[model samples]
Target: MDLATRATPLATTTVHRAGRLRTGGAELSWHADRTTTPVVFVHGSFDDHTSWDGVVPLLPPGVTAVRYDRRGHSGSSAPGRTVIHEHVGDLVSVITELSGGSAHVVGHSYGALVSLMAAVRHPELVRSVLVHEPPAFPLLTGDPVGEPMRDAARAHVITVAEHIEAGRTEDAVALFAEKVAFGERWRELFDGPQRAMLAANARTFLDQFRDPDHYALDLAALAAGPVPITLTVGTDGPPAVRRITEILAERLPAATVHTITGAGHAPHLSHPAEFAAALARHLDRTHLDRTRPA
Candidate 1:
């Protein structure tokens, strides 16, 4: 995929407004308002909450849209050797402080796993969970059918780490672009924030990969849990990512799946209006607006 071929057909603009929230040990930078049923957005690996900028305004004006820099991402404090628990704990505190202990949540890629885990660990804090293409790789483990996929993915991570440890940051970045990101298409994203964010948070990606719980979760427990989850994928998304959503939907009967036509990977960026609509509909259906301030 050449960068030209993968380039967005339209020139999209962003609305930039920034503020900071004092949460736990880190002062999280965010954009939001105080409202009963706030919407909290979590960004995937190598990105910050501003990744939701284009999609946020399209959400219903009646609802509050909140996003923040996760630890180690842009605009957030970088603590030493943080793990999945710390990430989850940050979200728990943020939601409690921002939305009075309950809010609708949307997470993309790596953030999707974090959001789902938050719901699983603290259902009382979440009114709904929406995820896009989370690489829940652990679900591919143990079974004869999925074990190979797991091993291959783990090997890929290890190789990328090895490259970085060799002090070959450029090599590691290129490998990540070609292997994990969409090959030459990654260049299209590099012209903006994606490339810089990936570079800035490279070490945290290492920590995330090393964290046993980074991609590990008990799907059965989640499936039987109370919070309703909706998983969205782009129609043109990679087969592996589509498979993750399929397996998750199959396991969690309460889960709903939506395909964004003519989009891939990042729907919030590629198909902002549709993504926002889907999110608003889910929140309305779930009556998240009814959540009261704590």
Candidate 2:
């Protein structure tokens, strides 16, 4: 069933009779499958829930699924600056309304960072978490590989913001794509969605870089937080992606790390089957572990 027909868990949440609802700085759109203990997926920058189209069918049976647009992405409305933490708050609301407080959360790229922060900030709501290649740039500050990653990220963000600010959105998106090494592969992998995402989300990316703390998260809080998190990165992914995951995993050594052998940054798009299977297995294991007597 869609989130529209569903009665929300709380009256405090700003929900609309329509398929849209108010959350933070945006009117968000959400979809939900009709099972319990939902698995909520959060998309990265410039993407909406539909990006999970390829992976949804492959999920384990009997578990509910939910996904939503962040502020200013896809069907969601945005009226203010898009701070990353604001996205975190939105995820909290989505999970609250969809799962009545608990869900296995999965997030990709920038969304991954938001998931981690949400787990830390609202530990009661998350059962387990999986994140793919979140660009947690602050983790790389002292790393040899991470330093270059930071430099590249800073350069890319500044240039992209400049272009967007100058009303050169096409040029800004081209530069952003180039920085990510989008190349022919991004076009080939995403079909038309990538271009559309960039055009729709150029301004969001502008505010994404406004903070020096934009990419920074309290890693120690994440490591010490109660939720069990799994960091997933594609083997063929860039150095920065892998390094960020590695640093985070090292900090949370008890947490798991899984690699998709042939995959790249956008594993759901580039390697949907593997990504879906891994997530399904993790959910299975988490359920089994929870049910086991300690």
Candidate 3:
């Protein structure tokens, strides 16, 4: 299960719909396998569907894995306003159209926040949710721990907005990759190719930053929902992210939390085998329960 090699066979394509506009005219791209239950993949800020490039093929034969560019990112429609709720709406529409019903959802980083919101809002449309390192800082109560991290996230968002307004997307991406993505491990985890991808998608990354609601709205609703969720934090993730996972596991009803060993914020990219194995196990458990005598 060499993740880099597995990524090669995964195909890419764009999706467009004229009748509905969740994110003010949505455009999406995805990777699919015709034989499986559709698995929708959502990426965080600064990346596109390709972020899942390293993990898509590792999915079993019966799962159709789909990843999309967030509105205003990559080939997706560029909406004038960006917000987390809007992104969640876009996901609902996309999932409805692509999966023909509720589907299994996997979201990474900020994308995880969006997916959680969708589950909360449209629980009927989601069978199971896998959220990897969602930054739900404002919602994590009982913690003075999140105060500094939340402030840092806020400042980082402001910095990104300022840089983008100043037409400094490259610098914004660099800073985000260094300060947010890999954090202390930026030098060790992000290779030449990863850096290139981040640099290329700087504008979209900045879109999320300029609009604080891109994360805030989702975090607000995550605490109120009853959606069944699987929360994952990379063993090497930032302390804040790990704390958020702990909060969800402790607070969210019907939620399970797990940590991926030897992985960071992006385990799907860094340790595809372990990531896929975890997913497979989750899917198996859920599927069995759904079919059990009731």
Q: After superposition, how far is residue 205 of candidate 1 from its true place, in Å?
A: 0.4
Cα lDDT computed for each candidate against the true fold: 0.74, 0.77, 0.70
Instruction: State the lDDT of candidate 1 residue by residue for 1-294, as single tens digits.
Output: 111111134312223345776655676777664333577899887678767767765665456677888888788875577687788888887788766788888999888988999999999898889999888876666656656756665676688888777777666776766566444466655554576676776777778878877887778778888998999988776556667787888898889898889777777866788998899778877875455232
Worst 10 residues of 1 by lDDT: 1-10
Q: Which candidate number would show the highest TM-score if scored against the true structure?
A: 2
Top-scoring candidate (lDDT): 2
Pull out the clashing pairs in model 1.
Answer: none
| Tens-digit lDDT track of model 2 for 148-248 | 87788678778888989998887887776656634336666655656777677888888887855667778788778888888898887777778888888
lDDT (tens digit, per residue) of candidate 3 on 1-294: 222222235533223222323444665554444433667889887777777766766765456666678776666776465777778888897788777777889999989988888887898898889989887776654478777776776677678767777888777766766676666666565678766766666766655665657555343455566556788888877777787787677777667777799788888878877888788777776682353234
Regarding TM-score, does 1 or 2 come out ahead?
Answer: 2
Ranking of candidates on lDDT, top first? 2, 1, 3
What's the residue-level lDDT of 291 in candidate 3?
A: 38
- Prediction 1 TM-score vs. true: 0.85
